[model samples]
Target: MSDNDNRGDKPQGPDNGGNGGGGSNPWMKSLLIWVGILLALAIFVTMFDGRAATTGGNTIAYSAFLDKVDEGTVKDVNISRDMISGTLSSGEKFKAYPIPDSTLVPKLRDKGVAISAKPEEGPSMLMLLLYQSLPFLLFLGIAFFVLKQMQKNSGSGAMGFGKSRAKMLTQKEGKVTFADVAGIDEAREELEEIVEFLKDPTKFARLGGKIPKGALLVGSPGTGKTLLARAIAGEAGVPFFTISGSDFVEMFVGVGASRVRDMFEQAKKSAPCIVFIDEIDAVGRHRGAGLGNGNDEREQTLNQLLVEMDGFEANEGIIIIAATNRPDVLDPALLRPGRFDRQVVVPRPDIEGRIKILEVHMKKVPLAPDVDARVIARGTPGFSGADLANLVNEAALTGARKGKRLVAMAEFEEAKDKVMMGAERRSMVMTDDEKRMTAYHEAGHAVVAMHEHASDPIHKATIIPRGRALGMVMRLPERDSYSYHRDKMYANLAVSMGGRVAEEVIFGYDKVSSGASGDIQYATGLARDMVTRWGMSDKVGPLEYGEPEGESFLGYSSSRPSRMSNATAQLIDDEIKRIVEGGLDRAKQVLSEHIDQLHTVAGALLEYETLTGDEIKKLIAGEDMDRPVPGAKVSSVPKAGTSIPKTRRPNGPFGSPTPLGA
Candidate 1:
């Protein structure tokens, strides 16, 4: 391999020179140099001043002529021996023994005085300074690098906190334009102007018109309030800022208000943008009204929101959209003409609207060729867009579970049943006797509702367990209605009482189940409303009795001092009892008249476990039941378009019923 290839394969590092500086730490190099220099200086000093002598045995005798006595040696020399003669250093001659060089050599070595014939090498002085300072220099460098990194990260960290948390989607995300939002045709008309303004704001501004400051989307939950806002963004092709009302709140006192300001600031920067706030009721609730602490953090947030919304210098290019299910609880100031200038109500889809919603959701799913969206729509009377979408998805899932490629009609039917009655409880055990009793109870409700309440016909009847009920009988209006008349109320009460009345009539006594508890409560409430609130009681003389007596000493009162006194109160109670008892009696009478048919229907329920309204009618009148009764016109059943004509007839199936006055 070439030198270039070898270099690439080998790991490399920095090189240092060999004054103990070659690949050596500066501090260690310096220490080695200093120790070498000290050793060299000690060797030179030992060479100049040498001491040498030799001895044998314990003593040595030295006889020499008297040499010149050095002044340095004569001053302190004195010798003495036991049993031998010695001389003192006062010019007196005497014999003496001296120590040996062997002992002296060890003494000199202990005092760091060694004698060597050859000299040793020593370290350099410059290497010592580098060795002493290298560790502190390396430590300072490391700390400087770490602090710089920390400062860089802290500066960049601020960018993340200031960025808006809203997720932005372009045209590629999904196609849910204004065309897909159906049912609320009127609402769509109102929002179209917004799309126009967004498309060309200068057009409206040139004519001296300002876009609406804000629009409030008010509706029940699941009614596509949020969907409409998204559609507006998609149609306008503008950046959409979406947030929930709760997002503005935080533990800090002014965090919510600060967030409101920040949100508007962001929106202003992105001019011609839509800012959608879902569930606005969280912070926009009526000011000065809330439970608990009462310091009102939500109110402060709402106040900031109001100021930002209306106090902006130039709001021509920005549009605000807010949604709330509880429009009733919002502050009046927030909804005034200048603020949420347009209030669009997105109500539950009507039948035609539901069909359109079904069409929209059915696009992606593989539905059977024979499936009819209109039929599904008719089956679902009060369904919203979200519910319809869920229905389609659920139906598709049901088909997939059955190992089918496309959703069949049967799958859709099952999904609808699941949505309406709740999931089936095959594990819900019931005794044969209990099942029979449930059948009879449900049959009683269906038969009376079908025969008496021509306006409220039986939709379906079943003895199968669903939700909390062992049996259920569904009654639906003949058509979509916005108002309920007095007769309809009385008919509803009679239907509600049918189950207990049938149990009483057939068994010659009452065997009520807790399942009828809700029914009883509903009936009782209607009776009270008739007497107290509706003034349906003749004794009460067309005066509402349930009106609240405001600002009383003992809080709100349900009753007021009447001119009729105590006896009249007694009469009112009697009238309420009479009205409720009359409903129960009428239900019993209707069930008795068709006693055999009721048993037949109940027996069928025990066999099939469920039956539709049409099926129950077949069981009631046999094959001939499809035709009207002889000499009794079906005219009492109002036609599709006409109003239910007021006529006082008999108190039987054909009677003109009246709601009990509350």
Candidate 2:
């Protein structure tokens, strides 16, 4: 609960690598400069065109010009057929047009005004051409600007296709220090040295220590790998360049490679900065593993990245930090020492880490006194930092929906259910018979699980439809368990079979619905793992039979065919079935022995729709619950589900997946 709160930490650079997050781009400045130059050139041309511009000489009436010529007051005269111009006796310049002008030249000749027969000096050919083409030049400039603007808008403007999309984050944007990060403290400690080195390199240099070149953050999704990198940058007060690995791959050949070079160029200018490539597996895959041709765009991008990291010329003070969930797919060369000098495993947070993470997130919320972070952490086994953050957000949102001043424990419980189990689906209509069957199914699970000493305790049981389940029983582990015990696995299998067992006992074999599809699928998978992988089956000794991932990208080997002979494969299958049937039989036996308790639990579910673990115990003991009776749901009229998937855990393994029977 005392974990330092970084609720305010929202660090918001690269290569002054200033083209960062919201920083100014050099290309944009260049574009503006070109526009200004074109404008200045157009103005210059308009000012200098001799023939198209006025001479700025004074004008006089034609009759006055005649009077001047007659008086011989004009010292000199220059005349064309249409007009006359001369310096008067007083040496002032003047110009006049001839009226009914065939005699204009003759009059000028009579006056002896030194008139030239050549038409008053017309503009040069070069000037005429320039003046004529000015409009077209302006049109082309405008077209060029529009084209550049369109390209810029699409992020592929003139010369923009090859520019790096890496955003630079600076301290001024928002400072996110190590304090902002919670959970995965080991990974934080590993990265802290880098920040120290960046802040004062001489501290390490004096001791003959060279700054580590790179660090690879390997973890599952939502484990806070990217967040840690930003925290390092914030702590060190250095430029942070962030770009997704996918941003490097472009449809156009050479574009990706060009971007890699450009990104490094920007990073070099902002030396001692960190360049973080997120989801690096997108571009940093094994080069030849599944690549169609030797010279594809992604491969080229990867190759260029390799050169930039450790090429002929050294890149000083530039640190490379990359993140990926699938480190197995990354190229080996990229992982060599001096490149990614360290591989920091940012695994899912443990129970203690989760509590700290909860504390950090809770600081932003108005939490009720009853909101114990420890309780929430206990229920959320296998949750990552991102999951805990999301849990807090969901709880706050739930509280706001209820117009509560503070987020309470009830809201956190509901948010957890929504996060792990699918959200409540009360609108999915069910016939009374379906409802009764679901009640019996969930009751069987709760009863059978209660009988298993090794099984995790039931947290909640609901007959109301949720996610894809018509009903479900959720189990909360006493503590976070990394590896499952053999007994626990068996208990899980029995609990999984409980729903089907209950339906068969009450409704008979012919009346059983397909509601057990997800359970059966989960059971079969678990049993197979137990037999083939865990070596739980005595018949099949401990040996990995087949690879879970046999499919690979670009012909790469991510899988191996089962090495066991046909007969051996058949034996493995038999063991799996045997394990499953054993669990099912155990479930049947437990449900039969506790038949009365199962009925009581089911009746309570029908009455209340949902019950906590203690409530179930109380009802079985013939005690009334203190809570109010469940009311009808607001959206209970029945709506066809659009979110519920065929599988119980549709969102997959990122967050706390809907546990078996949950």
* C-alpha TM-scores of all predictions: 0.68, 0.75
Error of 1 at 649 (Å): 30
lDDT of 2: 0.77
Off by over 4 Å in 2: 1-138, 147-160, 291-293, 548-562, 621-624, 627-662
Residue-pair clashes per prediction, in order, are: 19, 10
Top-scoring candidate (TM-score): 2
Best by lDDT: 2
Q: For model 2, what is the alpha-carbon lDDT of residue 338?
A: 80
Ten-residue region with minimum lDDT total, candidate 2: 1-10
**Residue 180 in candidate 1 has what lDDT?**
76
Off by over 4 Å in 1: 1-169, 291-295, 312-314, 531-576, 624-662
Tally clashes: model 1: 19
